[model samples]
Every structure is written in structure tokens, then in C-alpha cells.
Target: MVNSTQVSYFTLTAYFDTGRLKHLYFLVVLTLYILIISSNVLLIVVISVNRSLHEPMYMFLCSLFVNELYGSSGLFPFLLIQILSDVHTVSAPLCFLQVFCLHSYGGVEFFTLAIMSYDRYLAICYPLHYNIRMTSNKIAVLTAVLWVYPFLSNVFLVFVLTVPLQLCGNLINKVYCDNYYIVKLACSDTTVNNICGLVKMFTVILGLIVLIIYTYIRILKVCFSGSKQTRQKVFSTCTPHLASLLNFSFGAFFEIVQSRFNLSRLPNMLRIFLSLYWLTCQPLVNPVLYGLKMSKIRNACKDLLFGRKIYL
Candidate 1:
């Protein structure tokens, strides 16, 4: 407390301080984590093994599910330890790693969702030229970009921008490691970091938002002007994407807004819920939405489980 020095560990203050409910919280979180991992892994396996489901759309879905698992793994294990341990602190390096994984998870989700929307656009609006426009090589390249670009972006943010900062405090008033929270705790001026982060956020997040909106608009127009079969096909494929998008967007909006401002009046439990909703909800929601809502994926999963043609 006498002088400022490099901080080694940060205390997470967003968790419930009550010791009585720790076991209950741990059990709930563990069950949810298990469910998330099982569902995402199952979908990934079904998508990977079923040759008929090896199309561009399913491939992207597989990648998305894997990212969900990656993101959840980054936080859940640490969270379980925290729940059981007497202290709730993370070392600086591990905190930054969590930041990178979770932020990259959000970025990759948006980018992948954008790509999925574009795929839907091509398939629905240009049925004849869809195969040519969305070839295997092209989809593979796009998928690589979706995974790589977000990671590189976050690497720069964490290493180049964040590592240099001199932090005044080591207590983060949130359940997870976040770039914004780290910046806020910096002792020196973070004008450059703020500006760079804002620009990157806009370019990646807002750009994807615009792309999704445009693609959906075009898809709606095409569906409106197409035949019954065409409309049904579009709805069947597009509904799941829209649901996932809206679910993620709602959680992200709350987190972003809450992070940017000092929401001191809000209850602690509510704050924690807002901050973690995306990480908790999207990972569990996507597999269920896609598996149950999409006939092809559902039937393929049934066939895989029963070892027989369920509907074909």
C-alpha cells in the first residue's frame, strides 16, 4: 500500500460472499458446465462423422460449437476452483489468458454468425450459383479467418495494449477477467488503449452486426418473393441463426453497457448475472436450438444414436 508496484493477483469481488451457498452454487455451475460440454461435443461429433452433414452450414455450426466449449472451458474450471477454494483470486497471467479466450470467443461468435448469415443469403437468394460461390475451399478459408482473426486481435489487445499498463489496484469487481476492467484499474492514462479498443470493437462487432442485418434483409426479401417450398426452406435454416443471434446480442448488450458505466445501484447478483449471461447462455442454447429446430441435424443425430435411418 505504500507505493505502486506490479500486481500479481486480482481478487474477484462479484461472487457471493456467503459461504453457506457455495456448495449449492458449485453444484449448479458444475451441472451446467457438464450439460454445456456434453451438448456441444455431441453436436460436434454428429456433424463431424455424418458425411451428409458435411456441408458449409454444418461445418460452420461445428466450429461454433467447438468455440463455445473453448470459451466455457476457459472460465468454468477456474470458477469451480474458486467456488471450492477459500480465496477468489486469479494470477495476472491466468487472468489475461481468460480475457483472451472469452473475448476471442465473443469475437469469433459474431464473425462466424456473420459468415453463417452470408451462407444463408447465398443459398436462399442465389440457389443456382450458391455451390460455386460457396465452395469447400472458400468455406474452409472463411472458417480459418473466423478463428484466427479474433485470436490475433485479442492477442494484440492483451499483450501490446494491456501488458504495458500500470495498474493501481488488483481487485476486479466482476466474476471474470475483462479487458475493460483491467484498463479501468490502470494507474496511468489509458487514452490510447481506450481508443484502440473502441475502434477494434466497432470494426469487428459492429461490422458483423451490419453484415447480419443486410444478409437477413436480403433473405427476407427473397423469401417473400419465392415459392412456398423456398419460404419453408429459408425459415427452417434461418430461424435457428436468428434465435442464437438475438440471445447472444441481448446478453452482450447488457454486459457491454454495464461495463462501460458505473452501475453501482444495481444489485450485485444482477451485475454478476449480466456479466456472465452470454458465457452461460450461448454455449448451452446454440446446440439445443440447432439440434431440435433443424430437421436435418435432428434426424442425423437420431440416426447416429440409433444406428439406423430414422426418417430417410
Candidate 2:
């Protein structure tokens, strides 16, 4: 049996060179974190308090906002501390914890988006049976499954593969502790780990992508056959979802490129930005897109902020 040794801490790359400008970088990041939290929380509260807003679509949208907050929290606090401190080191347990949260964040995000698409498809295509099909109990169960599946999947990955490995290095090249980066440090063979990771990715990520596309195709066909009003409604509801999918897909694409290819000649800051664009942009973009583009949510936010009720 191989004796396993543990890494106590990992050194993360700071976003910028250590200089007077570091303070400026810290302030900007802190501001963005604050904005992400505030906006997501605001959307959650609006959805929760307004009785009219408590429908299947809004429920899934709330889950999406909460997942964004969950994922962002995993990174922003750790990032904030790194920005302020002279050394960018994170404890091993904390690193693992961040990996779990961020990974689950991505899994839950795709699943939630898939569910949202299904909810829309049912609402538009089967209006007469929508309520019968998407009951509150059913919605709650799906939301629970979306959150639980990723958490448990990551748990298996971290425990079975990551925990037993003997680490050969402690210096993570990125600003956060990524699972692949941690796996890279292992002295033992990672073939099993790689295979398991790919399977999980296929099930959680690619599977959801396929489901979302199928649901959208059905919804589009229905929309094309319906009246002008039906088409307008479908467009209003789906535009935000599609925009979010494209935005997040681009971010995921950047990370995949960085991992699979050599772009080391690129500036460190640029590479770092590309790696983290999804985490930075999604939480901020989701609430903004939904709040501004969806009339009901927009009116609700305005009513909450301005104390003027606008009926939908």
C-alpha cells in the first residue's frame, strides 16, 4: 500500500503584481462581489415576498440566483482575503471546500437552466395541463434534486479520488484551488480520477445541454405555430435564458481552452481573467438580465425599490 501524505496549504496566484496598484485591484474586486451579492439577494427577496411571483418559472429563476450566490461566495471571500494579504495561501480543507462549492455551482447551474427550459416548454406548449404537470410539490422536488445531485457527485469525487492521493506540490498556479489543479499535484496515478471526472462531466454538463436543446426545439415549434401574442410571450421568457446560456457557455469554453492548450505566452492577468470570467460575470448578469428583460420581474423590482405598484 502507498503511504499518503497531505498538503497543509496551497499558494494561489494573486490577480496582479504586488505593487501600489494591488489596493486598487482589491477595491474593484470587492465592489464587484458586493454587487453580485446585493443583486442576487434582491431578486431572491422579490420572488419570495411577492405572491404573484411565486410560479414555477420564478421558482426556478430563484434557484438560479441562489446558486449563483452560492458559487460566488465560494470564491469571493477567499479572493478578498488574498487581495488584502501579503501571501496568497489557503488551507487545504478550505481549498477542498471551495472546489466543492464551485464545481457544484456549475453543475447546479446547468441543471437549473435545463429545468427552466422545461418549465417554459410545458407552460407554452401544454397550457391546459401546465398546472397539472408542474405542481408545487413537483417543482420543489426538482429544485432539491438539482442542488443535491451536484453536491453528492462532488462528494464522491473528492472523497474517493482526491482525498487518497499523495500530493507532490502545493503551489496552485491559479487564484483559487481548482480540482484539476489539485489532481495535478498527486503523485499517484490519476487515470481513475480522470475517467471519473469525465463521466461526471458528461452526465451533469453535457446531459443538461442536450435536454435544454430538446426542450427549446419543442417550444420553438409551438411558438411558430401559435398567434403573434404567443410568439411574443415565448420570446420574452426565453431571451434571458438563451443570453445567459451563451454568456456562461463562452466562459466555460475559455476554461476548457486554457486547460487543453498552451496559451502561456498570454499575459498572466489575461489568462486569469479568462479563467474566471464566468464566476465574475454570471452572478451579476443573471439578475440584471431577468430584472430588466422580464416585465413582471422588472415591474416587481421597480415596485420594491420605488414603492409604486405596477400590475402585470
Candidate 3:
């Protein structure tokens, strides 16, 4: 029964209504965010300083780390503010920017993962040509394309779909600003927006997943065909990246599916928890998994932390 004009004036507000759980959630998330920042920053520094990590795989990893940092920064600071102040109000422009950054980073992340898979494929399946194929210039071009393409996609989405919407219910069901939540709040029919979102999600998730799988299959074939020592070495090298891909894939899937389903009936606290898990936890898991499961990164980190220089 609310008029469009009234909806324009209205704003969504979120707060921690739970008694002790809110504090506990905030503490846990804050701690995790700190760790994410520290670990990713450390990784970037180490990779930059360590000459041995200048190869394509590590370069891609560094790029992923940078994107993860940006992704977390885009989502977590606003979330923490909302949690602490018990105010989740966001202006329309700010909300759009939030969605833009989120999607931009997400799209870039998808491409980065795909590029990483290709890097592994080259390294494993075409070892002799790997250096030539994944040279510094080629890597730079790939990285630039990964970032630019996503930015353009988000820009197109905003202009073509979101700009025309009329605001009805200003409340975004989820904690952070998301494309679907914003579209759902539109007073006007959002068929086009929803369709665009679906198309982009499908193309990015399904298409990229197919590519990653194909690349990995080829990698496996090459690995198993090689000597046992080579096979083991390849497996060890790829295990950490595989873990990262799994973490990212699950998180992306969860976000896309959750956005499609109308889960407004769920409690706000639960929604907050889910959002935190999807956005913050996924990125945090990457650094932890890489540091613990990858011997090179772990030893490098140890040396850096202990003020010892590790050669290679």
C-alpha cells in the first residue's frame, strides 16, 4: 500500500537485535577480518620481494590476493559499521556503488580463477612453452582484461537495468548491498534486471566452471602421463590453488542461489551470519589454506615473520 513517493523517502535499516550473540558475532568477524588483511598483505609483500615467486602462477596468486582484499574491504567495513552502530542505512548512490564494487570484484575473481586454471594447464600440459605462454606481458594483458571486463559488465548492468527502477521497499533483505536485493526493492517491474542478473551469473559461474574443469582434466592427464616424481610435484603445486578454487566456487554458488530465493522470512541475524560467512569467511579461508597447505608460502611466511630471508 506504500506509494512510490513514500518508498523514495524510506530507507532500509539493520541492527543486531540478539542479546549476547551480536557481540560474539562482531568479535569473531572482526578478528577474522584482521587476519585476512594481515595475511593477504603479507602474501603480497612476500611475493613481491621474493624473486622466485615472479612466475605466472604466483603472479596470478598475488592478483587473487589483491582482489580478495578489495572484495573484503568493500563488504566488511560497512558490515562492521552496521553491526557496531546498529544502523544499516545506506544512501541510494552509496548502495549502488557497493553493488558495483561487489559485482566488479566478483566478476574479476571469476576471470582470475579461470586464468589461474589456464596457467596450471600450461605449466603441467605444456611445460616447455609455459614460460613463453605466460610471460610478463601476457600476464599483464590477462590481468588487465580480467579487471576491465568486469568493470564494464557492472557498468552496463547498472545503466541498462538498475537505473530505470523505481524504488518501492528500500529495505535490502541481505546485510550488504546486492544486485538482486536492490532490484527486488524496485517499485517497477524488474524482469529485465532479474534476467540480466541470471544471465550474468550463469555465464560467469557455469561457463567458467566448465572451463576450469576442462583445464584441470587436461592437467590431470598430463600429470599422470609423466613420471611419478613429476606427478607428485605437480599435485603438490596445485593442491593449494585447488582448495582456493573450491572455496571460491562454493561461496559464489551460495550467493547466487540465495539471491534467487526469496528468503526474507529468515531472521535478520541469520541473514547477517550468512552474509558474513559468504563474503568474509571465503576470503579468509584462502590465506589460511594457502599458508598451511603450501610449503613454499608457509616457509616464506615463517622466514618473513622471523626476520630471516629465505632464498628462493
Candidate 4:
């Protein structure tokens, strides 16, 4: 109805009329959201209340859980509303806000995992020196960087680069707002935006990947050489982190591919699943992975749920 510069809101063209079944879809999404909130909150509370879980590793995990909640909150509420509402549209400001929140979530998630891997490497490789190396002050600094970097970076990019873009269209062909798609919709010359995006992908995102890989390689080197008991200990500690990394990586891969390639040929439901996978799966899977795999978290969660005062 309007040109790019005149656009005030975006039409999410991906959503179709689910008819009366939308109520069922709404119920399903609501239930899933509740589960994510409760599970993530549960772990955060468990770690916070249990003095035994106040270690550096658990502290990192608590941050991860909080990030999951932060990320999920970006989409799930808006998703529930869109599922029920006939109009699948969002104001430009709200759309930009969602993009900011989601991007910050992703950046923090990756850096947190990277930090966790380094923590693992220290604990396994250095052992006795880990405490000295990973002191409270160091942990606090690392934590601050992970949270603040993503936020500052995202807000700057969204507010400065994205918010001012002159879009050619307002139709966002996804279930939710994405910065990449919004850039694609821009009518103005986006050479600078494109350059910045590529730089970010290769530098910030790739740097985190390399850091994680380097830490894991060192850990694995130590793992294979250590005694069987040591190997088991490493396996127990590293399994959840590896699983989480792989899960998030897969979803991110799908997202990057979908944004770059022609994925419109896929079924609408399948496409929707792929788009939402990274955001939804991580929040759900992290709690399960950390809770079930780590005995400490597992026992803490069990005691909390069953009203038992026992601490393992």
C-alpha cells in the first residue's frame, strides 16, 4: 500500500489462515512457552539457591539459562498473538526491537558456550590451576563481556544501520522479524550494511567458533591422554556443552541457509519449524541436557520439584 520510505509497519506474509485450528495452535505455543519459562527459571533458581552450585561452571550455565529466557521471550509472546490474530503485522519499531533482542540472544549464547568450553579446558587440562586461572574477578569480567557486547553491538547495529534503512517493501516472509530479511527489503544502497554484516560473520561469529574449537581440541587432547577415570569425568562434563553447541550450530546453519538460499519451496510448516528451531529448541534442550546429564543439576532439580530438603 506504500513505498519503502513511507512504510510504517511490516506485514508478515508467511502466516497463513489456520482457520479455527489457530486456537489449537495458540494452545500449543502457549504450552511450549510455559514449559520453556518454567524449565529455564527452575534451573536459574536451583543454581542461585543451592550454595553447592555456586561454582564458575554453574554460574556460566545460569547465564545460559537466563539468555534462553531472554531469547524466547522475544518471539513466543508475539508468536502467540500472531497465531490468534487475523492480521500478521508489526510496527517497524517493534520489529526492530525483536531483531535486537534475538540477535543479542544469539551472540550471548555463542560466547557463553565459548566461555564454557574454555572453562572445561581449564578444569580438565590445568586441573589445579583452574581456580587461580578462573578466579571470581575473571569470571565476572567474562560474564559482563558476553552480555554487554551482544547488547551494545545489536542495539548499535539495529538503531543505527537498520532503523534508518529505506525499505522497498514491508512484507516480511517469515514467521518472525529478522534483520537480514529487513535488510533485503531495503530500497536504498546497502553496500555498507552488507560489508558490516560480512565483517561481523567472519570476525565476531567466526572468532567465537574458532575459540570454542580450539578449547575443545585442547580438552580432547587432554581427554585421550588422561586415565580412564579422567576420561569419564571429561566426558560427563563436556557432553552437555558439546550437545548444546551442535544443536545450536545446526539451527544456525539452517537459518543461514534459509536466508541465503531458496527455501520457499519447502512446506510452510517445515519452513516455520526451521525458522523457529534455533530459538525454541535451545531453550528447551539446554534445560534437559544440563539437568539430566549433570548429576548436580539433576539432583537439585529433583529435590526442588519434590519438595525435598536433601542436597547432594
TM-score of each: 0.95, 0.94, 0.89, 0.97
lDDT of 2 by residue, 1-312 (tens): 232235778888535566887788889999999999999999998898788998999999999999999999998888888878888888888888888888889888878888888898899889999999999899989999999998898898876678788887887888987888888878788999998878877776777888888989999998899899989989998999989988988998998787668888998888989889978898889999999999988889989899765333
Query: In model 1, which runs have C-alpha deviations exceeding 4 angstroms?
Result: 1-5, 309-312
Candidate 1 lDDT for residue 103: 89
Clashes of each: 0, 0, 0, 0
The numbered model that scores best in TM-score is: 4
Residue range 1-312, candidate 3, lDDT tens digits? 343334433244545465667777678778878998998999989888878777788888898889989988998787777666555577667777788888888888889989889888888888898888888899999999888899998998975678567776777666777777767677778778778768976887678889899999998887888899999988888888887778777776667666677667887666656655657766788778777877877888888889897655
Error of 1 at 311 (Å): 15
Model 2, stretches more than 4 Å misplaced? Answer: 1-5, 14-16, 308-312
- Clash pairs of candidate 3? none
* Global lDDT of each candidate: 0.88, 0.86, 0.78, 0.92
The candidate with the higher lDDT, 1 or 2, is 1
Could you tell me which residue pairs clash in candidate 2?
none
Which runs of model 4 end up more than 4 angstroms from their true locations? Answer: 1-5, 310-312
The C-alpha RMSD in Å for every predicted model, in order, reads 2.1, 2.1, 2.8, 1.6
TM-score of 3: 0.89
Better TM-score candidate (1, 4): 4
Q: What lDDT does model 3 reach?
A: 0.78
